[model samples]
Target chain A: MQPKSVAVVGAAETTRLGKIPDVSVIGLHADAALNAMKDAGLKPSDIDGVATAGISPVELAHYLGITPTYADGTSVGGCSFMLHVRHAAAAINAGLCKTVLITHGESGRSRVGAGGFGRAPSSLMGQFEMPYGVTSPPTMFTIPVLRYMKTHGVTEEDLATVAVIQREWAARNPRASFKDPITVDDVLNSPMIAWPFRMLMCCLVTDGGGALILTSAERAKDFPQKPVYILGTGESVETPMVSQMEDFNSSKAFRVSGKKAFDEAGIQHADVDHLMIYDAFAHLPLYGLEDLGFVKPGEAKDFIRERNTAIGGKLPMNTNGGGLSYMHSGMYGMYALQESVRQMRGTAAAQVEGAKISVSHGVGGMFAASGTVIFTNEK
Target chain B: MARLLPEPTPETRHFWEGCRDGELRLQRCTDCTHSYFPPRAFCPKCGSRDVEIYAASGKATLYSYVINHRPRPDMGTEPHSIAVVELAEGPRMMTNIVGCPQTPEALILDMPVQVRFDKQTDDISLPLFEPAKG
Candidate 1:
């Protein structure tokens, strides 16, 4: 059976996501949700269903002042919010809810004093890998980052080039955390966080929240703002154990999710006008670009150095400054979708030219989980 | 740092005991002659319940590795080599390479290595692998 067509009628985000001193976690989520309703020109009464994630969800429902017909708080690494979008579409399409709000918030910067895990990792983590000293997400991701470098002969400078490109794009974005331009030399000289991964390559911890509202395409016409249709969405997961992974060089989940998304949307990579890939680390985009089939294997380094990822290149990627320069909330996938919606409506602060067709991707858990969504102006 | 600790179960008791003794023993299915680690009762290869706990040669070849330069507060120092070693007895193990600095030139893929144990305390000794020159 064909699913009902869903449209993204609202997109709202908090201020630049470094550390917010006074705001509580629920407060941050409430602010984003309230702003989204205003952006859609809809009231809180318009939201009958909700999908939330990242540390706190039920608490947010109580603060929002409405009981949802459907509520979900499934946290699957960092891509949980993007997955929520998929689940929300089904809820809205099935008439389980007239309107759905998806939200996420994290006080990572303040709770952990920035650069801390904030809370204990999952219990399974402590039982399996923690005793050996495999602690924190950066340390986990560094395994593959190092493997990719060794397998491809990719240099630390190659990793630094991604930071440079993203920083160049971030310089133009008003909401970007780091607006100051950084050179490749600056990245190379930065302190090493992990072997082969420097401080520059890692993402900055930020406290923030993002929100998106969805309704059936038929209901979108009544809203004041232009609606961005959810053309197609897909998700995939791989082995959570980094050691048991089939391959360390690239993420299989990206390929699986991207294929399903493109197939459902009836579009190809060549047809995409813009791409918003989640960038928790600099190597993230490099692997994502390759796994998404935008470039050949072991060629993303050359792809970035050739300036194909920048503005006016073959692909305009992470125009919102990306997590590298943008905000690295606990889960960055929501921001990617938010930016795509803004770009499609010609409302982005740093809009990509003629962005009618866009692709937003979210990667989570050390190359273990990935989700992809294709959005187009037309339903 | 907390996630790396091994939690020993009934099937894994013997293997962990071997590590304490500075010996690397693998679970072998006597019926099919299959070997495995992170010890288990049923053979992952042949699903045989009948198995033997025997000492392995402790020799292996480097399958893959990464040198972590960013060590967290609990984990002191950076640039440690975490590796996947293919055992000569036909099973794979996840371990670290010690007694040498972790560098691209030092931690090459397919390099021969041998197991060594670091006694953390009286009852606990961790297994670490290092390059073994013939």
Candidate 2:
């Protein structure tokens, strides 16, 4: 409830990202957790609280030999880590635990010790959607985008511009997976995975993980890394089926989640010097821009086309190139959170110049869940 | 390879049976008079247990869709359209667009459509949609 009561003291991704075939899912978790622990100069014994998605918090604690007083396993999908960060901040503020470690990892491409993405025969999605030939994220996550485009009169070129601009940002970061400059024509002319969606519009399916360490703001200075204060946080969930989203043009979950964080932080859109709207697909950031109040409805496409979110733009977004050109190991929220911290710490690969505030927002499932976390370097 | 079929629960069994009988059934809340799908015992809105199963008009408008080019083992070689159609009663459900080519040019948004049942098994019949006949 109290802003700036908590801060991220340490944050790190696995030692190497993008195609870590040898690392199992749990191994990636441990890799990121240990990396973050080392970054904070803390040991496994120092963590009194633990939280994660995919693997249970209990499993993470037992695997890392931590005896935690608080643990959370709130699995909502890719954005689950954002919720973990929010919950950990609350737990630390309540004095439930001294230090908290939040972790994420997915064997999305490698499938090493990875579980299948099957649902029960009687599950809601299984019953209604699966029979309709909805096979993967490309098919399901993209269900509503066409309607949004049709209503707004957005063109395929506008959609291609999203990937083009993100690739421009990707060219600046050394950690990016695809650093080559791509044109809108390149994106439009690429292989079509689904109608209105090309290969470039979808996120990369790589193998990677990231972690964050949270503690009381009072103790934040003791850590080795710059203290990235948790300025505000909010999260919400909507319908399970993509078809059931209240509106196709805008995400109710994104609106509710983003507005809560902004209201809680007591900041305006202009206050955010850096932003990372989860780009599991290109359309997400478009929806995010409008729903988060950064742009008016139907203006997001133009905002992006005019290059406001591109490199050297007024608002430098997804500086790590986002999930579009960056490494997306299934759950992309952790990576989004990591970039925010990097910007706030002033050590990002493509750091925004003197950025003081950063907002990281994410979606889970197909517009079904959302989480927003605001960070500031100002204490 | 077989397409995934529904294993109906008591709460949702009527929906499947309605499709098998060539009817698009939905649950409507009596208290609020709100209609909905993917059957639940209590009304989603107002949480009223006072609900009834009723046959819908089967008329809908094409709300949105994607033609998945990524082939699934269960789905055939031809690209298929996965769509969500808003029914005449206001509820939306996921279904396939049939009786037309699965292309962006052919399957226009907001086009009027009517429901058609594709019987999968004796118990599980799918409610697909096609362009409204003139």
Top candidate on TM-score is 2
- For residues A1-379, what per-residue lDDT tens digits would candidate 1 score against the true structure? 0322888888999754677978877777887899898989877776888888654456667788767788877777778777887878878777798888888777767763223453333343342345456656666676666567778989888999999999888888888888899999999898876667678888877888889999988999888889888887888998665665667788888889887787888877889988988898888898889988888889999999999889778788998889888888767888888889988999888788778898999987777788887787765
Model 2 lDDT per residue over A15-58, tens place: 98888889999999999999999999999999999999999999
DockQ of each: 0.42, 0.89
Best by lDDT: 2
For candidate 2, the TM-score is 0.99
Clashes of 2: 0
Give the CAPRI rating of model 1: acceptable
Evaluated at residue A12, the lDDT of candidate 2 is 95
List fnat per candidate, in order.
0.43, 0.90
